[model samples]
Target: MKTISWGIIGCGDVNEIKSGPAFNKINGSVLSAVMRRDKEKAADYARRHQVPSFYGDAQDLINDPGINAVYVATPPGPHEEYTIASLTAGKPVYVEKPMSLDAESCRRMAAAAAQTGTKLTVAHYRRALPMFRKVKTLLNEIGDVSLVTIRFFQPKASALVANSEENWRVDPAISGGGLFHDMAPHHIDLMLYFFGEPLSIHGHSANQAKMNRADDIVMGQLVFPGEVFCTGAWCFNVPKEFASDECEIIGSLGKIVFPFHGNEVSLHTGGEVAVHRFEHPQHIQQPMIAEVVRYFSGEAAENPCPAEAGIKVLTIIDRFTGK
Candidate 1:
């Protein structure tokens, strides 16, 4: 309660840098334990990270009395289960994005948190990142924002080539869908943060490349309050040179341009453009984790990304993918 002693479930590649080490780096927080299905890997991670404990079973980590918090770093399929378990065990939970396999699962997790009176936050870390924060400020300066567009085009990464069933990101049963499900939460959550609740959403998806069961392309249009409109397109089968990641927000007087995965922010008005850049931290999730720690420590009332915000995003994806 005074400090966050954390246990991580499914500490894999994402945990290796994006989030795992952040628990230790943040003040009033410590990475007390980690769990992975592979005991050797779990032990190795504990050793390398100097964590005091590690477990091959998730329940053991969840049950650890020393761990006051749990981070669900597993794939979407298991997120709901572990998050429910952690909440039931009377520990606060920080779950990865895309919250769960579907909106229903997200709903169940939210219910569990409510029942247990435990805090639950989603790792929509972009909400706390500097680049996105700058974009938000620019949106305000641009006057009454009326339109927004999100575009992500990338060639198929080698890892998404369906090398094995173990590559769960492309496996619908495990990942909820494909890379869009994996990556779109950041953009979608940012939209929610910046624009408030969506008035309506219309979406379509297709597996253009036939790379996997999940869609390789998705497009959506969302209408928000104040007659604000937004459109987004994500395509994973583009040529290498054609690859791009950008979001443009236009208002009556000017526009703001930035990328969800990049650091540059461009502001345009009066026929002039200004560009600003930011470098991400080595442990990219640290800033957000620090905020979560502060929330858990009772120094802050609001979670940076609460379970409700995460559920809204999954609902949007579910509406698009029809799942």
Candidate 2:
């Protein structure tokens, strides 16, 4: 097995804990280098993380002969640019979620991957997580899944938003829209992963708070092929008392309930309810990273989360935001 030397672009807050260190922790993977537009900060990150090298230019990192795979951790705006560049360089890519600023960009990125025959995976890492896999198993207990309700409410400047100018989540030009664009990819992807493709999509977005440039409220509905329907409501400017992150899947026999951001799942069947609790890995992305490494090594037959799947998600977002 060959080591997959990873060069990460946009070593920002997301990498501070959620993913950065996992490269070396996983066998057959190494964090060889990193890149950021700010050369001084790039070197600082390199030194603190003990990375061998750092660069101000993404191309410098991508062209590094030692790097075999690239992790594009930048905002969605540049996802297509870096992904295509890496694939063109004959290197695979593991891009962060919300694949691009919009569905069209996602299509272009997927096209590049197809043209180059290079691997491209999205960081919908939740699909490979144990809790969600258990949720998938528990779904079987729900006789005939019919409806899913998703609710994610937060006050202004929620902890998840990462208070910084680099807060790309709410910047429409960079993240495509507001909190909905930033967070919905995970829920939407998991929905498709669990229930399959939708037959129709409907949604609307509004900026009720007008606190920022992006929309604060978004409501969406999706009807899947199996008569499964999902309705989602996301509000980022809710009251402090009303903050909640929950999703419920209902079926004829029973129902399953869990938080999209939490680690507990509740199964309601028969006359009783059972709760399953899980602890996230120190690096939650490590499991998916491992699978990507195997796929990169040619030991795994397929990438864990392909561009097609991520693009499907982006398409759904387009419909939701009415873009």
Top candidate by lDDT: 2
Q: Which residue pairs in model 2 clash with each other?
A: none
Task: Supply every candidate's count of residue pairs whose N, Cα or C atoms clash at under 3 angstroms.
Answer: 0, 0
Error of 1 at 183 (Å): 0.6
User: What is candidate 1's local distance difference test score?
Assistant: 0.90
Cα lDDT tens digits, model 2, 200-273, are 99999898988889999989999997899999999999888999999999999999999988899999998999
lDDT of 1 by residue, 1-323 (tens): 77899999987877887889889888799999999999899999999999999999999999888999999998889999999999999999999988999988999999999999999999999889888888888887788989999989889883333233277988899999998998898889999999999999889999998987889999999999998999999999998888888999999889999988878999998899999999999998999999999998899998888899988999999887776
Q: What is the number of residue pairs that collide in model 1?
A: 0
What TM-score fits each model? Answer: 0.97, 0.98
What pairs collide in candidate 1? none
